[model samples]
Target chain A: MDIIAQLFAGLSLGSVLLLAALGLSLTFGQMGVINMAHGEFMMAGAYTAFVVQGVVGDAGVSLLLALPLGFVVGGLLGLLLEATLIHRMYRRPLDTLLVTWGVALVLQQVARDVFGAPNVDVRAPAWLSGAVEIGGLALPRTRLFILALAAVCVVALALALRATPLGRRIRAVVQNRDLAEASGISSRATDRVTFFIGSGLAGIAGVALTLLGSIGPTLGTNYIVDAFLVVVAGGIGQIKGTVIAATALGLMQAFLEYSTTASVAKVLVFVAIVAFLQLRPQGLVSVRTRSLA
Target chain B: MRPRSTSRHGVTRLATASLAALGVVALSACGARVDSGSAAPTTAESCVDTSGDTVKIGFLNSLSGTMAISEQTVHDSLQLAAEEINADGGVLGKQLDVVSEDGQSEPTVFAEKAGKLITSDCVAAVFGGWTSASRKAMLPVFESQDSLLFYPVQYEGLESSPNIFYTGATTNQQIVPALDYLAEQGVTSLFLVGSDYVFPRTANKIINAYAQAHGIEIVGEEYAPLGHTDFSTIVNKVRSADADAVFNTLNGDSNVAFFKEYNNAGLSADEMPVVSVSIAEEEVGGIGVKNIEGQLTAWNYYQTVDSPENDAFVEAFKAAYGQDRPTSDPMEAAYTSLHLWAAMVEKAGSFAVDDVVAAADGVTYDAPEGHVVVNGENHHIAKTSLVGEIGADGLIHTVWSSEQPIEPDPYLEGYDWAEGLS
Candidate 1:
């Protein structure tokens, strides 16, 4: 019974990791832009939910509205960043990293100034506050909701990237920018759209995150490194690889934590990732391309 | 080209030789220190200027970073205390000149700022430090400079420094009373959950010793890293262990996550209550009342404590800040610390460190928490311990009390079970 409960816990935790890392996978993995301010975008979404709840005074209704609103808020911010800063430093990954790090600090201070440094409470909807007790296992509705939300997002994103015309353009630009431009795809426009979608996904993840953790300016920093780890360890630009890696890491964390301790479990997971990277630096799934840069 | 290269090598060698000579001289100069039998080195003479109409005191706190949210409250309370003192005819007939510096939520920064506050700012004393790590980092600096610091936060015991005054409750005044309350409530089995830090680790050690002596079975023990939000697996362990109650020592934002997860796991205050040491009135709102309405918290004071002094303090605090702001245990302790310091300076009729120390023993103050006395030997104050239940209105109301103020026992010297533990 304990083992079964542990498995569900792992799956739910993996869903959280997958949700947080999905946007990073698109921006850092597919776009090849190191966005250190990606976490701040998540903070923005959480704050949006807070503000929505304040104005609406209804948890369920505000949550429903915050999703789309969070997407727009995060998308606009990403579009602004890419146009003003990231566009000029496309070829300088190192410079982009530093510049975005500075942007992250600035955004955190802005959040502190606006909302204060303290963590704000976002009350959960009454319907989602209870747990489903099946015999000996107690599954929280909040965790279950997060799991379902992650699944829906993954399916929607997968379908959108495979079946849509915008997806095709994004793929073309990602594959060969010069050829895509020659073919009249307008790579710059595609890049902006792609960044918009990626960061918007992050915003949705942030809105979902308010159900589980404290919402504050520094909330993003706690999960940002884990998100990057999932993206990097899964193989850049591979959604399927990301899914598998997040689940695997989540299960490993659960079992290790049960056997040892949380701090020890974290150390072991990082050590394992380092060892895995040393063996396969190309990650779990490598892109098979013939073009030489 | 060969002659130029040779000249460059000779210049480099000469510079290296001079640098090595300077390093030797510096090391020798440092080696002339006297052993004072304490961690502090040979002290510098006091540079505090008290001849003027104003006496400076420093307020060191993390105004930014992860700790900013909590430390900012301490800073605000300190400011309020200073203002109140100045209004009531300043300490020892001179107005207080305050110097504020940000600790940046880092221990090394705390140490560095402490040194600057003593050596450069030349403040007679310093106030504010929330975390044990910050206090530990600043301890040696205070001792070396022979300055005073009044730290206002409940912490693990087994520590005492002459140069620092602990206004907050130590183990006997807070944690032991909490355990006694649980034991009296017929909780025979327990689970321990805490943030992985010095305070929790030491507090848990003390709990283990107490439980062993009292025949309470500890079913499980788990620690999450500080700031770690996820608590699913740990909560699962708590559920399966079927402990009668849980002893939670989690600090900061982790409490919000822990209680949320605990509630989601179908745990309740009625069946298996979690008695937390860190959650105060201010934190109750942040965790959301719905998630932790009936939860238990152990502290020296709560905003809901009914007393004329407390009423006045709360009113003044709300007037100074906003009506929405809540006065907590640490904030009250900080306010009391300044008053206590003023009393000591008045009793001694001087601002010198030695005079203040000589007059500190048995000095009492009518603080919001109650009438507290300073134990000058250990440099901690006697405080009453109250166990509070979080109410629906987002405040903590006292459900249990120690009945009278308990003396500070930082080293647990009175307990036979705590022998050789420190």
Candidate 2:
């Protein structure tokens, strides 16, 4: 029963990680930009939610209003970054890495300056405040909500890519930018929309994060590395692979932590990830693209 | 030949880069001081500018990083104390000049800034250090420089330094008394949960020994790294352990997540109460009263402590900061430390470190918490222990207290069980 509970806890944690990494997968796998400032976009979304909460004055309504508000705010900012900075470095992966890192630092400082250093309390709505308990198993409603949100996000993203016209354009550009450009698909426009949606997903992840813990300037930073790990380990451009990897890592961490110290568990996870990467360099679900060749 | 020569230069550059990186890694591993290039000391005699009509003292707090939220409040209280002192004709007819420096919430940074304050700034005394690590880092610097440090935070007892005066409650004054209260309440088994740090580690060690001596069963022990929020694994462990009570030493933002999880786990105060040493009124607001309304916290002072002195102090603090600003034990201790230092200086009729140290014994102040007296032996002050319940108003109200100030016992020599442990 304890094992089941612990695994359930891990699944919930992984769900949040998946939500956050969905954006990274889209940007890094599809857009071919490192986007080190991905975490900062998440921070921006969390702060937007905080701002909306202040305006609404009621927790439930504010949170409801914040989801879409956060998406738009995060998406528009990502588009702006794509135009001004990221677009120039699409061909230069290393330069994009450095520039995005710089952007992340700048955004972190801006958050600190605006919000102050203290962790802000974003009160969970009354309806989502408690937990649902069975005979021997208990699960927080917030965690369940986040898990559901993650599933919805992943399924919706998969559908958008497989079914929608915008998804087709993004897939075309991602597969062969030169060919997509020649076909009058407007690769730049696709990039903007893709980047916007990617960042918007990160924004929603940030909102889910606030439900679990206190929000701070570096709230997203704590999960950024893990999200990167999920994207990398899941294989580039593979949403299904990312989900599997996130769940596996989360469960591994929780179970490992049951026996060992947290720091040791983290080190073990990193070691395992490194070992796995050595075995499968192209990741779990490698896509054969011209870029890979 | 030109290509070979360029390759050789590249090899040399790579070697140099690797060597520099190795040196940095090695130095950081051993916690060795890297010389931070700052201004050279330009003074022949202590470098203190006592010739001016102002006496300069340093206010060192973590103005940035993880600790900034907590330390900023301490900074504000320290500022308030300084202002109040300066208003009261400024510590021996000279206005107080404060030299503020940010610790950046790092121990090395604390050590570096302490050195800077002592050598370059040449402040007579430096006040501020919330964590044990920060205090430990600054200890050697103060000792080597023959300076004074006024640390104003309740900490794990087992240390006493002549250079530092601890104005806050020691473990004996807070932790042991809380344990005593728990034992009196007939708690047989205790589950210890804490942030992995010096304070919690040491506090748990003492708790372990105390429990052993008192014939109590230890059900479980767990720790999470500082700033870690996911408490599900640990909370699951706590739930399964089924202990009579939990002694939580988790600090900072971690408490918010822990309480939320604990509440979600349906663990009420009546079933398995948590006696926290870290969470206070300031933190209750952040953690939410709904999550931890019935929870117990042990501290020397609370915003709801009733007294004329406390009323005045609270009002003055609220007037300076804001009405909503909750005054916790650490903030009150910081405010009291400045006045205590001033009183010591006045008693000695000098601002010199040795003089102040010599005159610090038996110095009493009608502090906001209550009447506090500085212990000459340990350099720690006497404090009353108050166990408070987290009220709906997000304030901690005292439900239990010692009724009198407990004498400072940095090295728990009074207890036989705490002999080898300390």
Candidate 3:
């Protein structure tokens, strides 16, 4: 029963990690640019949820209105960043890295000034505020709700990335942007849409995190490192690899915590991931470039 | 490379290293010349001098994290106390000069700041620590450097470092009294819940032992992660357990979640009461008055503590911050800690860490909490415990009192069942 309970906890936490890293995996791999401010983008989404909740006191009303709001805010922030800064450094990845790092610091400071340093509570809706007990096993209903949300997101994202016209275009861009552009794909518009979608996905992650814990400026930073680990461990650019790595890391964390302190458990996760990365520098899975080697 | 340029780089390296050494020598030398009470030679000495015109102290707190809202009050109160002392012609004719540092709310950062306070800044004593982890991290640095630290937040006891003084109540003085009050009210069974960390785990260990020794039975013990906000499952477990009371040790936003869920589950204070040690005036307001009102909280001081010293403290704090700003237990302890350090320095007659430590055991200060005396053997102090019910005005009304202060016992030595536990 405890192991089963632990698995649920693992799944719940894994979903949050997947949500957090989904945008980073896309932005880093497809665009060939590292978004160091990705976590801060998530922070913006959490704050947006906070403000929306404030205006609408009813939990149901707030959540009902927040999903699209989070996507728009996150997507707009991404668009603004790409237009004003990211586009200039697209060819110079290191310059983009430094610029994004600076942008991250600015966003953090802005959040500190606006929200203050205290952790702000965002209440869960009335409908989701209970737990189920079955044969001596206790489970938070909220965790199950998060799992459902994560599944829906993953499916919708997968279908959008695989089955739709834009999905094929994104895949074409991912495989060979020059070839796709030569074939009339309009790679510039594709870049804009991809960056927007990537950022909006991260914003959705932030909203999920706000539900699990209090909203704070550093909330994104906390998950960002772990998300990078997930992306790196799962093999960058592979969504299937991300799912595998996130679930594995989550299970490892749950097991480590049962035997030691939470801090020690986190340290173990980092160490284990580092060891895994050392063995598989290309990651758990990798894409094939058509060089005959 | 030319030999001349190599020699010049080498000379630059040598000169810079020597200057750093000289800087250290100068700092250690000033330890002998501090301007407070006179008790040491004016030349090179092992101790800091407090006999100068202005005694130097340090205020260390996290100014920028999850702990800032809570720790900032302690910082403000420490300054307030220093100002009040300087106004009264300083301690033993030395006005106070305070050095400040931000701990950044990390354990490693606490150690670095503590080292800087002792070795670089040369403060006579420093005060402030909210989490047990930060205090533990700083303990070795203080001991190795032979500097003094006055930790103001209540913590798990089982500790007695010669160079540090804990002005806040230990489990014996605070948690024990809270349990006793609930037991007196005929709480036949209780549930224990807190954030998953060292302090709460140690606290629950002590609580379980006390419950077994007494007639009370523990229904369940639950813990959430530090920033955890979900409590639906835990709340359901508590409701199913049907304990007469819940002893909550959840810190930060977890409290807000637990309280809201408790209310949502149709649990009220009257049917099965909630007793908390961490939620004070500052936090009660933050957790929302509606969720926490009617619940009981335990602490030594409220903004409503009665006495001339408390009146002065309240008025002066309001004057410093504003009338609407409230005072809580930990901040009062922090203010008292600085004054107590000053009193000990005056008694020892020097800021040399060991000299002041020798005089720390039984030093007394007429503080905001009313005459808390330091126990030199242990680093804790004697403090009265107050059990208060939260009112709509956002202040805790003292409903039960200890009558006299409880002596500091971090290890729970008095209780037979707590044997070998510390």
Give the lowest summed-lDDT range of ten residues in model 1 chain B.
B1-10
- lDDT against the true structure, per candidate, is 0.87, 0.83, 0.77
| Model 3 CA lDDT for position A82 | 92
Clashing pairs in 3: B35-B50, B35-B51, B35-B52, B36-B50, B36-B51, B36-B52, B37-B50, B47-B352, B48-B352, B361-B376
| Top-scoring candidate (lDDT) | 1
Lowest summed lDDT window (length 10), candidate 3 chain B: B1-10
- When 1 and 2 are scored with TM-score, the better candidate is 1
B321-389: candidate 1 lDDT, tens digit per residue? 999999999999999999999999999999999999999999999999999999989999999999999
Local error of candidate 1 at residue A134 (angstroms): 1.5
Q: Count the backbone clashes (under 3 Å) in each candidate.
A: 1, 0, 10
Per residue, candidate 1 scores C-alpha lDDT tens digits across A1-293 of 98888899889889999988898888877777778788888889999999999999999999999988988898889999999999888776657777987998999999899997778999899889979999979999999999999999899988888899998887777666677788998888888998998899889888998999988888787778788778777877778878988999899898888889999998899889878876776567756544443
**A60-165 in candidate 3: lDDT tens per residue?**
7887677778878888999999989987776655567679878988898898889876556576786766456667655665666767877777788789989999
DockQ numbers for every candidate?
0.26, 0.29, 0.17
> Which candidate should be chosen as best, given DockQ against the real structure?
2
For residues B1-56, what per-residue lDDT tens digits would candidate 3 score against the true structure? 10012121232233233333544743352232222212212332334455568767
